[model samples]
Target: MAGREEQLLAIRIAETLSRAAEAERHYVKIIEGSSSDELEDPNNDDLHDAEELLAHRTRTAFRECQMLAERLHMPDFAKDIRKKLKAYGSDAKLTSLTYSSTAGEQYCPALADAWGFYEPMAAVALGGAVTGLSVLETMLRNTAKIIEQAKTTPDRETQVRDAVFGILDSHSWTRAGKLRLQRALKHTNRT
Candidate 1:
């Protein structure tokens, strides 16, 4: 009988393989929807769409295989995936931007204008613009400083930033106050 760790590894491998197979199916569907002759046309929208679909599927497959390789302690296999992705002109390194759209679902004019640049001063300013002016300003300044100075992993930084944003969004600030904060957040690129 397989040991517990072995069993878990096997399960992970199976799941990853399943996802890769599903991605392959989607790739096939995209190819089948477009004729080869049409794909040869430089101005064909279908050709561009097919290329985009294929690239997405390739990236998805690479991620699944790379993850499985890492789980199985196969560093070489992961390296191979990275090489393949590079050959295909895709970035193998993963970041938040890779998996998410630039702007979130709810549109903020300030954020849109700034392309989501964050400024610590915005939060500090928000503190003084509200009813709990002094207290909020002090708290925001402290929190912002902590976030900026903390030596943490990229994922941890993302988590902290998300939490801060959640608090700001959920707080009972006046509409104008919120707008001002959003504008501040967008305008300045200070860390």
Candidate 2:
């Protein structure tokens, strides 16, 4: 029975990872498609439309990632991930994650690796965001900081920075990014 339970847990973990991957892919598609557009074109409705779609998809992906992470028993992964992210700096990484292709490729692997390391906090943060918890904004800002840290630091800092970036850049919580922002504002309003 214990062996069976372990197998079940493993299966659940795999499924959650798969879902997170799918979310990342969707985010990638949005990013790739957005960049392919002609920025100089006067009739750039497609770009705008694509941006909107990307935002929507990002949110959906984030919510799903949060759900899956919660299922995997790593509840506080997002929060811890946020803490690690704040250690790095948020703006630099956020710009890179959204704008730089080379940065994306280089940093994405680190971000993904970080996800594995800090899955529990991430899961909790994501869950709180999805469920409309009061703490969502604080979580998002912290996550943004984590992404930044992953980008600019060196050595061990770099490792943690990359992991944080990977988790943010991944499709796992693209949409959650915006939701987190909203939550942050909501949190401010209450205080």
Candidate 3:
């Protein structure tokens, strides 16, 4: 029962997240399928385009989140988040996968530890982590910080968290039957 504004924001976030995930998957598949297994495209122009598009699209999530924060009246939070995300763009940190979300900063190397160009953190999750906090925990926390820092009236943190979690739980971010978690966790613990 979200308000229209929150509903719209959630839809926007979901779409942006979906687009980013698609781009990452396309790029990762190309990287993983390459004969050389190097970060290079291996004479594949499509792969190069996919790589460029991933960077562009991934960085764009920041803007969409920023805009949502503004609508939520958290200008300072949006600015801070954008500042941190600035380095992750295609123009910066070329040939690597990097992510900074709430709870901590995470890194995904281009020629990574067996994952190659793809970073698992960039699982392109629409929801938060299946195993832990939300995928955008750090970004959302950054948004919350604006309220704390600005000394805004009333407590909006609960609403923010609820809205975010609710949006994620709405199932727009997950593929059908992919929401199963306990089994995945058992397998992960074994490794």
Candidate 4:
């Protein structure tokens, strides 16, 4: 029989795993539909779709915190969320995370406005696809570890910079390099 602490951890792990599975299915579906041209679309909402997925995941993470607080009878832990969110009041971008997007739909213009580099990023051909998949994998992995272990790991901030460097740090546009990355998507179906 699990103790209360163990039960809380188990619930947190279950919630995290559920969100990861949901995100995987959503992204895998989108990737299956992605053609080379889809990335090139001015309305490329790949990351935006991801944002919606993550917004839900993020909300769930906070909810898990509240769950833990409730189960443990720690009022301060639950109250901290409001204080933390309030701290971001000046930066509306950061503050907006408090609002969850229920629709699970992509708003490309919002994505573009939020990202500012979406269309340009989309034009990177296979580089964009490979990089996006890699980043998502890293993020999901870190998120899992964070929830399961309740430890703060350092790599999340560096993931994007590292991914971009991994994709572009090489020499030139060679057939071999392009082919290598294209091969990474072999398991994926692009229409």
What tens digits encode model 4's per-residue C-alpha lDDT throughout 70-181? 4445577557644543443332233132222765543322212222211222232223234545764764556544443433344564453344333444535466755565
* Candidate 4 minimal-lDDT segment of 10 residues: 117-126
The numbered model that scores best in lDDT is 3
- 1-191, model 3: which lDDT tens digit per residue? 23456446656666666676677667767666677745544667877787677666656656666666566566786676577565544543533655546525333342122122112222332233333344455535675564455455545545554444454566565643234443453475589
Instruction: Report lDDT per candidate.
Output: 0.46, 0.46, 0.52, 0.45
Clashes of each: 0, 27, 4, 0
Instruction: Give candidate 1's whole-model lDDT.
Output: 0.46
Tens-digit lDDT string for candidate 2 (1-191)? 12333334444544555554554555455456554445546477654454444334333333444444445554685355445445534323321233447565422332354446435434433433334344444445576576565565545544653455465456355667756754655586689
RMSD (Å) of each candidate, 1 decimal: 19.7, 22.4, 19.5, 21.7
Number of the predicted model whose TM-score against the real structure is largest: 3
Score residue 170 of candidate 2 by CA lDDT. Answer: 61
Name the runs in model 4 displaced over 4 angstroms. Answer: 1-10, 17-42, 85-191
